[model samples]
Target: MILVIDALNKHRFGGILDEMYKLRARVFRDRMGWDVMVRNGREIDLFDQLDPAYIVALDGSYNVVGCNRMLQTTGPHMLSDVFQDILCGEPPLRSATVWENTRFCIDSERLKRPGADRTVSYAACELMAGIAEYAFNSGISDVISVVDPAMDRILKRCDNAPYGYIGKTVQMGKTKALAALSDITEERIARIRAFAGITGEIFLEDDVVADALAESTPVTMPVALRDYCDAQIAGACTDSEREAALALQRELAGMYRSQPSCDA
Candidate 1:
């Protein structure tokens, strides 16, 4: 399944975000030999602080298997900020409707079986579908992604090849990288779905998503109190104890509901 997490709701997806970063470190820094930053086992950069949206792919166990980062082209992005050489003298493209995609990687070691080819996995197609669906629904018309030739070939094999190129390929460290633009439309999404044999929505259920957010979020004071209440409720053996725990939970819920809204 796919989960879309943006800046406003990122606090809910902390665990998934950590897994994605560690996966990026494994794929780009360790496997691909990219000169990206890997601090304390996480491959993060300045762009992460810009509050970009992330489309993350999860397996049956809800573990993060793949992810891609999306940033508005009008803001700080890879193509304009770090990959200027890929443009080959051409001006970097920027627009409100166009978004930049970068740091696309999959957890190959965990997701790929012993004899499986990582490029042709279902996780790749699912991640692409998630990106297309999320962007199309969000009023984004185009996405320019910084990718290597291997990714370019994988996209073509999956029948989701880029419609146009931004510039010539340039050598970055040990890999040849270039920019490719893809249209975000229902037709494009449909084509990917057809290839991937996905019939219904690939997103997780609303309740499951909420639970993931609530469980993964960093523990604050309120959260710590809630955890204690939950533990009390779970350990209650006598009927009276259970009733008291339930009443405490209800009181905490009421208190939470009565708090002033931050957005207000």
Candidate 2:
């Protein structure tokens, strides 16, 4: 399943985000030898502070398997700040409808299998589907991705090829990289789905996410019931009375659990 994380709700998905950062550190900094920041096993940069949205793919255990980052082109982005040379003297494209995508990676150690075809990995296709669905839903018309030539070829092989590109491929560290633009539309998403043989929805619903998070944390008692329980405990005059109050509290807790969640 895929989970979309932005600045506003990142706090709600702390564990998943941590896993994503670690995966990025492994893929970009250690394996690819990119000169990106990696502190305490996490690859976080200044753009992360800019409230960029992330599309993350998770396995059955909720471990992050694949991920990608997106930022508004009108604001601080890679093409404008870090990869100005890629533009070859032209001013960086800035628009509300176009977004910059970068930091795309997958957890090869955890998700990859020996002798498995890398060209058609489930995690990779899920990440691509998440990006396309998110962009189409958010009124984004296009995405400009900074990717290496290998990734560029992968995109084409998956039928998600870029419609246009900016500047020639330039050597960045040990690998050659370039910028490619892809349109965000239902047709594009459908094409990816067909290629990946995915028939069902790849994105999890909000209520499903809430259930998963609730299962991980301790259940919180309702404020009024908690206050009543406290009052009962404080005002108890005998051991038997206190026991009765405690039993009532347990009953109330059961009732609360029986009630449907508001998020549901």
Query: In terms of lDDT, which candidate is strongest?
Result: 1
Q: Which residue ranges in model 2 land beyond 4 Å of their true spot?
A: 113-120, 213-264
Shift of residue 257 alpha carbon in model 1, Å:
27
Clashes of 1: 0
Stretches of candidate 1 off by over 4 Å are 113-120, 205-207, 212-264
TM-score of 2: 0.78
**89-135: candidate 1 lDDT, tens digit per residue:** 88889899999998888887776656443333788899999999999
Give lDDT per model, in order.
0.80, 0.80
Q: How well is each residue in 1-264 modelled by candidate 2, as lDDT tens digits? A: 888987655645545666687899999989998888876677877787687899988776566778999999999999889888888989988999999999999887876555533332767887898999999999999999999999999899888999999987787887878999999999999999999887887887645774565465445466456556645643444446545766886777788778788899
